[model samples]
Target: MTNVIFTVGNDMRADDGAGPFLAALLEADPAAGWEVIDGGASPENHTHRIRALSPKRVVIVDAADMGLAPGEVRRIDEDCVARHFLITTHAIPLNFLIDSLRETVPEIVFLGIQPREIVFMAPMTDDVRRGVAALHRTLVDGVGIDSFPGIAE
Candidate 1:
């Protein structure tokens, strides 16, 4: 069964670059049983590609405002996404994207990294960078998402 990670964010934005940053790391040193897709700020555009993969599981990573501290990472519940992600940079909401791929992808996970700021052309915040690094380590080590901390209620 193929497991895919779809990262969503804008590299030019500060904390919003968390997804792309992790994508780059995973691309450099990929993990077994996992495929990395840098969805950038327009993950909705990649639904066709994801459908083609017919992955067993799909993980979507993005910077979200969850009213948590900067750099905080959480496995966001699909239903709570709208409540927590009040502001989004993407053209289409993530929930819609998830729904679109649900038929092809049996399982879907949404990982959110709290952003400190999202200024255009600004570099990623140190705290968010650390979060990305932690996620990278977890993926590369094949430790599984269960070992990662935080799960939004």
Candidate 2:
């Protein structure tokens, strides 16, 4: 049994790159019981990957414009991800995909970083960078880690 974390985002949009950025970090420390997926720009299309892995608990990280101050952090559950997380991956929105995966992946969780700037292809803000660093530490410590049968698939 192992856990999987899916970092989803668009690299062009500054802080929106949180997911992929974290994925890069996690990929470095790939010991036993860890799986990192950088589902960049197109998470919905990666249904096969999710299904294939079938993690017990999946943590989806992203930057969302949640009307909060820059660098604010909010942990969203599966049901609420569509309402808060703002991603420019594809025509089909996150909410749509979340709803579709609800029955299939009832244990998915969301970790959102409130981004002050979503400017195209920009670098991440200092605040978001620090917050991501903090989150990276937490994940490394297994703050949200859990066991799943197919996570290693």
- Pick by TM-score: which candidate is best? 1
Model 2: per-residue Cα lDDT over 1-153, one tens digit each: 446677778878888887788788778765346688887888887766776776676667778766666766676655555654575655577777666656566576667777777778799888888877767777677654322111100
Q: What is the TM-score of candidate 1? A: 0.94
Candidate 1: tens digits of C-alpha lDDT, residues 10-129: 989899999999999999989788898989998887778777888999998899898888888788888777666735888988888888888788899888899999999999999999
Question: What pairs collide in candidate 2?
Answer: 12-121
Error of 1 at 147 (Å): 1.9
Which lDDT values do the candidates have, in the order given? 0.86, 0.69
Highest lDDT among the candidates is held by which one? 1
| Residue 59 miss distance in model 1 (angstroms) | 0.5
How many angstroms is residue 146 displaced in model 1 relative to the true structure, after the best TM-score fit? 1.8
lDDT of 1: 0.86
Clashes of 1: 0
* After superposition, candidate 2 runs with Cα above 4 Å error: 84-89, 145-153
